[model samples]
Target: MRIATTAEDHRIAVLAALAIAIHVLETALPSPIPGIKPGLANVITVLVLLQFGWHTAAWVTALRILAGSLVIGSFLSPTFLLSAAGAGLSLAMLGLAWRLRLGLTAIGLSIVAALSHMLGQFLLAWWLFIPHPALFKLLPVLLTFAMIFGVLSGTIAAMIHRRLTIGTHQT
Candidate 1:
């Protein structure tokens, strides 16, 4: 039992490392819009959700958010707050998807998570930062980008999952 728990911890650490790397890399990229990010890290998050479970995914995401923010010098800043909100919303959405368990594959859950994350961040900005009705105007743009990036990230996750599963089966 101890060995199994250790293995699980190791798995979570590895997943968190991958997610943190991706998150940091994405943070370095120049966004076309203030809130528009490719969210490539979400690929790993969704993969974790599908392969392990929501708890593992949550661990990976939380680590990524914390470590990524620390590395980028945004710890405890507004940037960190937004990142936390997005990740929290993403995990919540994934949790709901897992509970529903209605034959929704990783791709579907990825889309749902992505949309929820974006909505959460946008809402946070409107409520805490801007507090203006004009902030709501960005909804369409944010949702559109979220949908596109979600599909792309989901496709990437599916491919990685396919390759990993194939390799395991072959071994």
Candidate 2:
């Protein structure tokens, strides 16, 4: 049976556009380190997860990563592989966090996913490209960036979620 377009489809399209835009923009910016990025696109992921569901967030992330790489010409390259792995791992952790449903809010889940994403990318990079002990040396710097950006993204996600919830209630 053919699936019909619904409000959820519209939401995914809009969210995907927002995420891909952020991803492409971020790719254009210069970073101090090779793999260190703020992952501002994560804000959309968190918003979708909290507002819609994990499946919605997954669609957004997959489309963002794939389309962002194609737009930036990183498709099927090591960069794409690393990005895909990190996103996969982060999404896994997000699903787990949501299922657990502890007191952990978006901030907590974002931090968890951010750290996992960083570690996943690092490990994949080491195995697929570096294959040297020195690869581990970058862990500290990457993790530091991850923690900082994680908090920032989470805080932004939280604020956005709050506004969305309030707006819905007021409607």
Candidate 3:
């Protein structure tokens, strides 16, 4: 019925709004790791990808980064590069996973995404500002943390997706 469709549409919108909010809040939180974040917004994206498709998730993730940067006043700053890199890498991973039929349970996918994200940002930084190769000295450390955080975030997202599916089916 039209009513059911409308309600479902509204729920999708609400999920997207929540995704945006999570993006903003996560960005605002200070982390000891310079560019590290839980990327809580990504939870919604992964869920959306599993439920909807890669296209929808990609759009939501892109919007979150753009709007989040504007909200945090880091739109044109060096920090923005990191966020941009992460988004780009995340999107790529999502696409690959979808295409490869990689089950959401694969934590390695998240780790790869995270490593790519860190590399992207570092490459951007090196190209944009730091021309010296010596700057890469910190990469090993950052990469380690990236791997750990990526696994953590991925697990959380997967868990949330499982719960949402259960909730949807129960209702």
Candidate 4:
């Protein structure tokens, strides 16, 4: 029997594809520090969250992580684990913010996700890989990068959202 797919499914798929493309492309960019690349793909996630809802954003993000990892050849690896943990925590924070009606804009939400994502990955890496107090020193730097990238992605998302909204109203 054939399964039926709704419009929402298609929407999620398209968004996931976009996010995956961005994720894969991001891998090529050299980072000043390991694991310190700007998460431009998350711009799509923030846009999805604002335009659709947190549920759709979550679906898109999960698919992006899975497929992006597979494409990047990091599936089921330590990197993947760290990535998953970060994404899971980020999603949870977004959901909480959404449910709590915190009235956060794309920028605020992105900052929250970025900080949570960094913390989750750092904690996991410390517990699983390094297990040294010196690792804690890196937290401040990582968090600073997260905050910078978060603002950048959030600004991009907001601009895209505004253009889309204006386009919809125009036509």
Candidate 5:
């Protein structure tokens, strides 16, 4: 028996591949703190959310996390758990933002997603791995990085989105 696939599936696969490549490359970079990377892969997620709506964005993100984890050999590890938590929360936040019709642009949504992703990971780490009050002390610093990277990725996403939108119209 064969299964059928839609163009949407191909689109998701391509986007997920791009995101996974970015995710893997990011793992190679050095971070000042353990989990303080720029999360540049999420630039793709934000772009997907802006262009394709929440469902497609969710598919792309879920595939990215699962496949990225597998490729990075972090599947079912603590790192994977943290990533899953962060991504799940981030996607949920984006869904809510979309449903609310908040009229937020890519930058606004990216900032929101980044902050929520950090919070989710921090909370999971505190509750599951560390379970220490001292962990809360790092929240502010982590959130600061999240904010900075959020803007950076958001700006990149916005530029790409604009370019794609313009290209679509030109043809």
Candidate 6:
């Protein structure tokens, strides 16, 4: 493991900012599948996890969710709660995957993380917003897309990380 220096911290901050910007863009985009998103932001989270550590990645995830909510004016709503839950669960999964040395490809890790995130969000919604169990029926469809998009985003992130590492010494 590498100790993060001032330079690394600055780099992480820039990455986080880019992640947040991507989150905002995703939030603004219209999706044919309701509540389904490309989750482009996770690309940064995975990069953060790989480059820094799960702790820093967790912080980034939380900050992204909180700041994103405020920026979108959904801070006080149920949506915010859902987002927070999803972020927390996904961070936990990402950390566990790292610690266990899952050896999963980036796409696999992203799929696992995204699935956990969606499960967390849907569970929260079912518990707090929906009065019936039928709400869960919609999850399969949502999860399918989440898996696909997660892989796509993760692959893109992995590629970017690879490209960024070229000719650059690792910290």
Considering summed lDDT, which 10 consecutive residues are worst modelled in model 5?
Answer: 31-40
- lDDT string, candidate 2, 35-120, tens digits: 88899999999889998889999999999989899999999999999999999999999998888886577788788878999998
Instruction: Give lDDT: candidate 3, residue 90.
Output: 70
Task: Quantify all predictions' global Cα lDDT against the true fold.
Answer: 0.88, 0.91, 0.75, 0.94, 0.93, 0.83
- Local accuracy of candidate 5 as per-residue lDDT tens digits, 17-59: 9999999999999988888989998899989988898998899
Off by over 4 Å in 2: 1-3
lDDT tens readout by residue for model 3, 77-147? 88887778867977887688789986655355566667777888888888888979898998998888888
If the candidates were sorted by their TM-score against the true structure, best first, what order would they fall in? Answer: 5, 4, 2, 1, 6, 3
Each candidate structure's count of clashing pairs: 0, 0, 0, 0, 0, 0
Query: What's the residue-level lDDT of 51 in candidate 3?
Result: 76
Clashing residue pairs in candidate 4 are none
* lDDT for predicted candidate 1 compared with the true structure: 0.88
- TM for candidate 6 is 0.89
Residue 123 error, candidate 3, Å: 1.4
Better of 1 and 5 by lDDT: 5
Candidate 1 lDDT over residue span 1-171, tens digit each: 355558889998998999889888887799878879989999999889888888999999999999989999999999899889988888988898798886676678778888999988887888889998887788998999999999989989989999988998999
Which regions of candidate 1 are displaced past 4 Å? Answer: 1-5
Model 3 worst lDDT window (10 residues): 1-10
Model 6: per-residue Cα lDDT over 55-152, one tens digit each: 88887888788888888889979889998888888888888888999887667778877888998898888888885978878988988988888889
Candidate 3 TM-score versus the reference: 0.82
Candidate 6 regions exceeding 4 Å error are 1-9, 169-171
lDDT of 3 at 38: 65
* Ten residues in sequence with the least summed lDDT for candidate 2: 101-110
